[model samples]
Target: GMADETILLADDDPMIVDPLALQLRREGFTVHIAVDGEDALAQARRVTPDVVLLDIMMPKKQGWEVCRELRAESDVPIIMLTARGEEMDRILGLELGADDYLTKPFSARELIARIRAVLRRVAMDSARQASPAAETASDDDVVQLGRVTVDRARYQVAVDGEPVHLSQREYSLLMALLDAQGAAVKRGDL
Candidate 1:
């Protein structure tokens, strides 16, 4: 099922923006467009979209700056779009708070899939944070925190009864935090 989400697409090129926005709208998303980095920031504040597709090169401001500014304001997911497919560029985007990165010439289908994946992660995170005080664990190694659950015996995690796939690192970090029992775990300990 397609969720009714809003997307803010920031790109200076009409070639990419026009077709992409139309495709997103066809997929049941409310699409908004911005032609430059400054305009993108303005629209983001005005509309507060569920996701942002940000192009790297733009007049007046750059994508990285816009991403930094936006991240300071909210946890809104941002996907950095670039024509350059360099490893450094991708790493920089992620370090700058982008949830994902896509090199240009990507198919619309691939982009849509990425959008959905990011949205699911965001939803699960919010659910996990809903009620931290409700956390509990049993002798059976079943741990429950807010809407999230971790069954150590089965190596499984779920949110609101739905399975949530986690990377090995994520699972390990979660375990570390759980062991802390509301105390702060030193970063180096993880």
Candidate 2:
């Protein structure tokens, strides 16, 4: 639950940060604040936060730079926040490995929802990785969808018991979709 999660909020504006921090705290998250990009990186390394809410404009270092550095060091989920809603900025954030992005003037509820979604996605990914592909898998490893059966252990797939050819990328995409279990996977995530 949110009670156990720590959130690092990095933004220069107290007007945005103070109230937001209070709201998050009210929702039961342990909140950490950073006024600049450098401080953001510092707090992130120190606290090892469960998630990061990074604002795009800040002193010392920009959000994209911070996002790039953080992604290089850890798989911790990052949600980029910005007043700008340009498509290019959103694309750049995703390209830099941000887990999600939110434009400013957003409701606190939406922000919280995004945070939870990212957390859920990260947890699912971790669970998937915890089951090593190198280890032998029992019958439970097989996932069925419609006429397709995926043998995760064997890295093979069959349709109606007939082997189907799939590129590595295709197989990975298929696995990700199956992992969602009907959840809507955002395009940026894919």
Candidate 3:
């Protein structure tokens, strides 16, 4: 169903990369491999992939560096791959703007499920944005503050009829503040 999707798999191990590539291809995804984090960044810029499966420990540039750089330049979905015991690494990955995370030694089926779920969220958000009128609004869907308008259903914001680009966290924070409707939102409330 996702034949048009392209996934960038960045891992130093051929054993992991090769088998994962085959499985992903069989499931109708185009797979690209990067042996190092630096190569991963280069390939991501070149190919403009749909999603990235990044290994936390890689040569050249570490996955954290790659994820930070990618998040700065684009909002592409990133799923971090960490070793079994690296709970801190997984949390760090998310803080660095990863859309999801999967630990090492995971089954291909689980990985595929995560990818599909992420893609589906994106698709649904896109649909919501495209047809805002079709969805019911309970004052939380859209917010207007001065010239800026926030469309929470689609994760979009606009100012003076022009679209504005915001990262996921930025959008969430904006929505939260607007939800308060000019009331003081304590730091803990936010």
| lDDT-sorted candidate list, best first | 1, 2, 3
Runs of candidate 3 with Cα error greater than 4 angstroms are 134-190
Any runs in candidate 2 off by more than 4 Å, and if so which?
A: 133-190
Q: What is the lDDT of residue 79 in candidate 1?
A: 95
- Over 66-123, each residue of candidate 2 has an lDDT whose tens digit, in order, gives 9999999999999999999999999999999999999998888999999999999887
Instruction: Give each model a TM-score.
Output: 0.71, 0.71, 0.72
Q: After TM-score superposition, what is the CA distance of residue 78 in candidate 1 from its true location, in Å? A: 0.3
The TM-score leader among the candidates is: 3
In model 1, how many backbone clashes occur? Answer: 0
Pairs of colliding residues, candidate 1: none
**Residue 45 lDDT in candidate 2:** 98
* Stretches > 4 Å off in candidate 1: 133-190
Output the lDDT of residue 153, model 3: 75
- Model with the higher lDDT, candidate 1 or 3: 1
